[model samples]
Target: MDDAHRTRWTRRTLDWLRTEVGSALLLVGVVLVALAWANSPFSGAYEHLWELPVHVDAGDLRFDMDLHHWVNDGLMVLFFFVVGLEVRQELAVGALRQRNRRLVPLVAGALGVLTPAAVYLVIAGRDAPTGWGVVIGTDTAFLLGVLALVGPAMSNQLRIFLLTLSVVDDFIAVTVIGTVYSDDVRPGPLVLAAACLLALWLLGRAREWRSTPYVLVVVVLWGATVQAGVHPSLAGMLAGLLVPAASPEREDVVRAKHLFRSYWQSPNAGVARVVGLGLARSISVNHRLHEQLRTPVSLVVVPVFAFANAGIDLRGGALGEAFGSTVLWGVVAGLVAGKLVGISLGAWAAVRAGLGELPDGVGPGSVVGGAALSGIGFTVSLLIADLAFEDEADTQAAAIGVLVAMVLSSLVGAFAFRVARVRFGEHSADLPVTLTPDVDVERDHLRGPAGAPYTVVEYLDFQCPFCARATGMGQDLADHFGDQIRYVVRHLPLEDVHPQAFGAALAAEAAHRQGAFWEMHDVLFANQARLEPDDLRGYALELGLDVERFDRDMADETLAERVRAHAESARASGAQGTPTFFLNGVRNQGSHDARTLIAALEESLPEAAVRRRS
Candidate 1:
């Protein structure tokens, strides 16, 4: 090569290297500073800062929470809010805008989420498997950072594909975090958060408030949320969504340019230049800021979170023990095996059914491989681990499980991509696929006895106050309907929040063994607050049971198993919360009044009443 050509190439390479190094340094600095602050002698101060109490009052309800909790629970809402914005944006204008573009990522993401969870469940079973949701997320920033290091060796399309998949992965993670990882909520903080979000929307519409004011309000909302027992990071996601992504005067720039062109030949050329330049400059600055606001959140917030949460203690026998844990193995299997299997099967089925297609240069092998990689759940997995296991040992085990699964999935994905590249030579057309038809088969089956017109399914947690309220409403509905509806009581005990819920369920099942399920169910719901292990005997005696038989049944493993089976069935039927009702076999979550119950039952009934012939 000529000397001038070499010099030019070297300069360009050097500049690119400089930019990459600069970003790396900034990331490293943040990580180092956070670690130092967290581990230093001044760590107590850092911890104390998060623990500082903040209080808010609205009428009769007063709420307060510590600073650390505010950041995790409340601020994180904004994190999810931004995530929602990204998902919306992707569906509207980005890679996922097309069916073919979406299929690969969607299928891959589903596999990523489901596999790790299933693996976790299989390894840990019902009790310990609660953490299954934890190991089903992908850290987009880390994945992109790794990709960036590979530079031009990676295809531009592949980069875009990876980014799109990661964004979708983030959406799934945020939804899981919001729905699955929450505690029994207090109405005060929830209402406050909603009000704040509404206020933010109004401010955006007014377009008068600066981002600083919004940020401050967000901090306050975070504080309220922390006191409310919610993870605070959600507040950040909510706030980000309310921040405007486009300025009000975006159209004015085009109008001004056209007006300036007309003025170029007129007598007011000098004045036009001055006014047009000023307006253009202002518009440019506003547009730039607005664009920055709309930049992908996965690039910023996720990386910061990973840095903060990813640090392992790495001392004692903790590392070895984590590796040895079934929880960890379960997480690994779920992410690595379950994700690959579920995603591939779902995608193949979709293709065969004629509903979707694959991306250009991507094949089934590549898609499945990428799906496997998507199972590298790091962020959401850790959050689930925190929610699922209160024990420190269990938490560590889950973390190890997440770490292992992520590493395995990433390696597998990279290898698969390489293999696809070699074999397919990077095909440039999108591959199409078909989706399976959705049928109400489960709904039909749950209707009970071939000719049953309507099925009413009630999901109740033994310790829920709302479930107690629902018990009375449900009884009234059954009596009012009078053999018109089949009431199927499903156990759904919120065990994490109510420690005695499972025990109460066991007592109810024991009562069922003596053909007095309704009597026991009503008694248990009515006296949910007073239920103790000893209290079951008194209830059994009042119901005129064989006290010995009742006691024996209460202690029976079979009773506990039955309760667990009911709980699992409720979950599979999409009942996440207590007092969830399903009319005509359709799930309806949350407590309702007698009027609402009547309405639901009425809707479920056949249009024509069946007449019985005596």
Candidate 2:
């Protein structure tokens, strides 16, 4: 990942968090309104409204359901579908793609699921074992919202960890719903549903891009699943899983760009449609659907589901009875205590076993706080309560339990973060802000006068497209500042994403041996599409260096070590992705455009110089 891509990802993540937080606040308000209406003089009306029968009949396709059932069994499919889309994307290219990255969260989330059920079983003690699944899920919206409210100011790493864990939790919860909570299966419809799913698989295998086909097939699959005595929502998840997800290919992007340019020149309906389709095809179906559905799922489906389901009447001593009910206490203890212990223990064990490490800047305390917040199981918990219990009283008890767990979990998470800050002195919530091992004019690659008043350093990947765009910024800044600016470039090649990057970094080091480092740098960035060993050798030969010496230097372990050391220094300086810039000793936190770089460099100058520039 380059800095531009990483920055966009970070911005998207923050945007997602904000959206989820707003959705959570809306869900919370809806829940409160529901509770108020349920307990108010219009209590009967509340029940009557949801219980109102809704019927849909279309040429032998007959359906009869209450308003509540329509929301749960129908509209909520979109919710599960969106969740499945996210899971597929993550497994394909997002955070969960790497096994090492998935390890800690996978273990922690699995334990987080099981431990809660165990707690529920122990506490419920033969009273309501069927309700154990209620505690298995963490409501991601509410969890994120609560984390925002109680967690440290800069908690990007912790938020990412918790989000990954929550995704795992959701996957498990849906699996349990499909298998454990569904009605008895029927052979004929089961086979039909299987056939429909097979059709979905075929569509995926064919890499179908049109949404209409997928939507129609998924709807038919849902009906088949319902008839098969499976949860229809599971069909949604399964359908979503079958949708192909992959990063956009460079060729596809270039084609889309060309199509857009054509549309810009033509400005007609035919050209516009071509551009739209081209741009849509540049992204995966999974991403396209996720973008289209996430807002509706978050803003409407979830809130409507809450309104329909969460209106439990706490009248006639129901609240007092809930306090005494084992089911209520079971859910509360299961989520609040079990999640904390299980997540912490699982993470600790994973680290001990060398399975995976926590995200950078996340500590034991942050883990604990995140674990506590994992107890907030509002949405899916309520759904499970509806599925698990036949008795209304037990269901109400579980709902109350979920509400109480949410409050207790929030308080516990707050306390844990507070303790982490005060007692442990783990105050900083972001990665290190200062550059490590200050730039050395003698040791570093310098582009201008060594004694320049203003200094700019960049940790860069040679194969990264974003870094390639930034390659000329050094010369631009030098031009703008005359000899007053010194530009330093350090290798931080991201080998996982950019496989050719490490070798390219080594090529640069080899070129440095022949005093043509900048020449080789420009060539490599220019020919980013070709950075193999032969390409590097050809570029070296074109630079008029002794190819023999360059080859010898490229083979030197010292050059590789030098590159690795620079990567380590990049990490230490909070540069997770390249090209990461430092103005003076501080990390640059703005855009990487040459104009922006020039302005930032001007600001980094001495006060007198800055004033003169102003």
Candidate 3:
């Protein structure tokens, strides 16, 4: 190569090296720090740093958490947030967009996740199933690092395939972390987290995607997550997803147009307008923080987290004990066995049933090999291990098993792909499948008189006290407005805490069968405090329904299915909780009195009045 070509080549090589080397170094640094802190003479100080008391209070609002918990629960949320972003990006434009490419990785990931989990469970048993999640994640950095070292031996297609698989793996891991390893239930913190997320999203949409508000919101969300008995890392995932990642070039153009308009409208305005002008001058200022948030999270947050949590001291026969322990073995087995079995079965079923086809340039052997690699569960496994085992020794053992399983799975996956490449001769073809975002909405109930000018949609959960209040108020509005406003009640039961919510919903549907829906609706809301099955039936009889019909319908599969469909619809419409309202298709998801709803209804009315001409 010539001197100029050499220079260009060297620079390009350095850039690639930087990315690979930087990520590796960061991962190594985290492990070293964690190991050092866990075993060092200054371990106390290291632990204390994480345990230091941090508090934020404004008037009556005050919250606190130790340093370590903040990092684990709070900072980890940001990690998950980034995970969500990657997922959204992949679905929008990456490997996940193609059905063929997507299916194989998904199948591979499913197998990878299940096998290890099964291995862990069979070893650990039902009591330790929580630890199953521990052996169910793929460590993106470590896995990618291994691939980079193998370099030229691996094809670019394989590398992309691995990346896509890892992204899906991360998605599953974060979900497990959020749903499975969560703390006890509390509405206050949950509500706060929801509000913060909404605020951040609105700020982004209004072109006010500044870092300050986002950061503040994240902190509050973290605190709320801690308070809500959920792993605080969930807040990070929520915040990250809401932060837009449109390029700086586009942002600059938008900002310039906005500023020009503002200046044109107020030529003679004083310093106040000029200061306001400064705010509009650069969308860069506002967007700079959000951009930083995304970059640092991947480069710093995730790596540090991996290092801190991944380290386990391997002295005093800890390795031997880990192998001996059923919990450890269970985790290892679940990841290895469950992943392979579940994934292979799911894939085979999909293909045989004609629901999906294998990817091009990929064969059954490659798929199986990839499935083996999918058994490499590290990140999520550790998280679940932390949750499942309160005993330090047990936890360490599970971690050791995870580390071993991950390495073995990755090796198996890489080898499998290599064999497939040799056999299939790189005939890459896209798989055929339907990929649609899952809609969780219930659309079964009466949608109001066909072309009614106004539609009032109410989200109600049988267990929520606020929803009960809204039910009574909604009925009043419906009666008063008559033909002017059509009322539509949507199911949105909070099932996580209230286990019987679905049953309660079924009871309401049963009453509806006997032409006493509004009456049963009132009774359910009125007596939300005491919603036993018998109580619901009693209310049905009091409302003049045939008691036998109500009982039969309550147990009816058709009625239950309809209720479930409605609940799904509510979720799709963004109804996170009960007592949410919507006026003529516009969302109004929260508690509001009759007057407030009326005002909203009037806003949608036409300017011209209807007249009776003689």
Candidate 4:
């Protein structure tokens, strides 16, 4: 794709992943097409096409597998790698980063796995106990998609809970695939695979940021895994784990902007290439791969896998026999009934034991609904079903069971959420939507004209380096719009991470008493590393403020409370990090770059004003 198309597709894909309904519908459509083609006169062609041999040969190495194996072993590697990236991200900075926030979901997820496996074994022990792993996973794509369709109007809290739970499920599912379901052991190749994995670890430890090195290593690792007779999915996941995934550092962002400015001034291929590479390097490789790969994997790789695997020929009494067998009912009960009970009871027990509390807005009914939706286990469930059962009839039965469970679980979840809304009156389980306690000129420290037509409000922590960089971007916006834009900054001192932030906010407020708030603001951002009490006092002296009055005001409890109030307002406005922006009272969804923010401001202006400005 061209850059424009690529950008648009990536944005749409992220939105679909976030909202979840579109991708699920696409998956469902693909599955329907597969079934239709399988049952049609072209049915014979379906199996024949996938069974065609694929061959790969190197100078002294050769590998051969059918198209089906290629899909399972090859393209699916990207899917698992993306999953691993997400898991790593969660562990680093997402929901699971906080120990207390992660505890309840971890407990519930573990139980969710065990309970389903237990239920499956109970129902199908004598017949197909090995297939218990089939029900141990929840397909994140389908779960989120169906949840969006059937969940509460505002389900962010519950969504985070379920997403966190799925991370655990994914971990166990991949472990089972690699160990419990691998082919016969091959020690020499397995040893080589281990060495490759160690190399990956070493690269990460050494902070190797280049994507090319990681890619080369992963390719060799996958080949070793295939030769080792272990499932390559595990190799993919392990490689992903070793790929660093960190948020962009402020210094790196500033460097990227500098590189861009050089390219802007020179406008040559070499500088453009340098600028591109610089921008890419600012973002972690793991995050970049996830963003670029998730869409194609969801839309293409997964649908192809489904088409290859989900084509069950259920004619000639096959459908009746499949349903009649214990395997089908075992999967149904294990996923649908077991997941609901296990997750619900697990969450309850965790809360009772004070392990951790549920996310803020998720009520019990929402949890119940989310747990039911978790039963929609399609992708990994089907993969496990194929590995768990050698008998074609057994696999067919399990596949039918999965499809049936998806429909049933969706219905059950919808019913639960409906009951939640109507009976318990629990609705809107997400963060506050609009800017809370709308900005006032008298209250907020404002830049630009007081009566400016356009407004941009930023929630910032004085000690946050990102916030420091954002100060320049804010100035750029002010420069572009001049008196037409009013810029406001609210204190959102993340005291846990930025210890001196609260004190700095109070210092700014104290300076406001001497008509030097802007002076202190510029000084604090400029010298973010030194924000101790003594440093604040020094800054007041530097700003020509009355030192006695400033120190007394900084000591005032009411100033501290004002800072606290601003922090509370930031939270109420759904800002969890520094440098969150609100444009014309609406939250900015993506980047807060001057260009993007300027475009938004121009769009909001009257047509006559915009034309005149242009």
Best by lDDT: 4
Expressed as tens digits, the lDDT of each residue in 387-466 for candidate 2 is: 99988899999999999999999999999999999998777566886989898878899888888888888899987766
lDDT of every predicted structure (CA atoms): 0.62, 0.87, 0.65, 0.88
Per-residue lDDT for 252-295 in model 3, tens only? 44455566566677666674465465554353432444444555
Steric clash pairs (candidate 2)? 3-578
TM-score of 3: 0.55
Residue 133's lDDT within candidate 4 is: 91
Where does candidate 1 stray beyond 4 Å? 1-71, 74-81, 96-104, 148-154, 198-224, 238-250, 256-304, 427-614
lDDT of 4 by residue, 410-476 (tens): 9999999999999998786666657888989889988888888999998999988776244478778
How does candidate 4 fare on TM-score?
0.93
Ranking by lDDT: 4, 2, 3, 1
TM-score of each: 0.53, 0.87, 0.55, 0.93
lDDT of 1 at 62: 63
The RMSD (Cα, Å) of candidate 3 is 19.6
